[model samples]
Target: MTMKAKYQSVLDLGESLNIQNGSVTEENGVLKVKGTANTPYEKNILWDKIKEIGGESPSDILANITVADESVYHRHTVKSGETLGKIAKHYYGNAAKYQDIFKANSDILKNPDLIHPDQELIIPNL
Candidate 1:
């Protein structure tokens, strides 16, 4: 497959993430991609997808993904029935990290167990 076609999913994901200043090109046998992700989490996910398809340290692709926001890992919008533990698990892979999330959002979150839909929480860098 052509290099561009091989990494099409990564391009689709970048589009879905609304990556800014995105560009994709294939030169010789290598694919080149450049974009700015809104948050570190988005950039990380893009890299993860690239690795998943190309293997760790694959030489087939070169991606230049930048993060627009580095203050926090990500900004999560709470949904119905979502708890701090669930949110923490999704971001940090550990439900026990809920306390960290709670602390980062302490200004708006009076209690860790009391989050409502539409509330934006900062998924702090751990």
Candidate 2:
């Protein structure tokens, strides 16, 4: 199969995710994909899909996935019933690290327990 056909799923994923500056090219049976994902979570989704289709270590595909915002590890849009501790646990695997998230987003978050839906919080780098 041609490289284009082999990696069509990945290319489609880029489109679905609205990846910025995405480009795909095939040469000598190798596929090259480049794009910037809005968040680390988005980038991880792409990698997961690629690995799902191309195997754990596929040599035929080369992907250059970059996170658009490198300053913060990720940005989380608050949802109802979510707390800083829950968000911290999701990102850092430690509920005690909620203080880190609270400090990072002190401008908007007055209290670590008062996050409301639609509020965006910066998950600073560890």
Top model number, TM-score: 1
Q: How well does candidate 1 score on lDDT at residue 36?
A: 99
Candidate 2 scores a C-alpha RMSD against the true structure in Å of: 2.5
Q: Residues 80-124, candidate 2: write the lDDT tens digits.
A: 999999999998889999999999999997877788999989998
Worst-scoring 10-residue span by lDDT in model 2: 1-10
Tens digit of per-residue lDDT, candidate 1, span 36-96: 9999999999999999999999899999999999999999999999999999899889999
Clashing pairs in 1: none
Report the Cα lDDT for candidate 1: 0.95
lDDT, candidates in the order shown: 0.95, 0.88
What TM-score would each prediction reach against the true structure?
0.97, 0.78
TM-score, structure 1 vs. true: 0.97
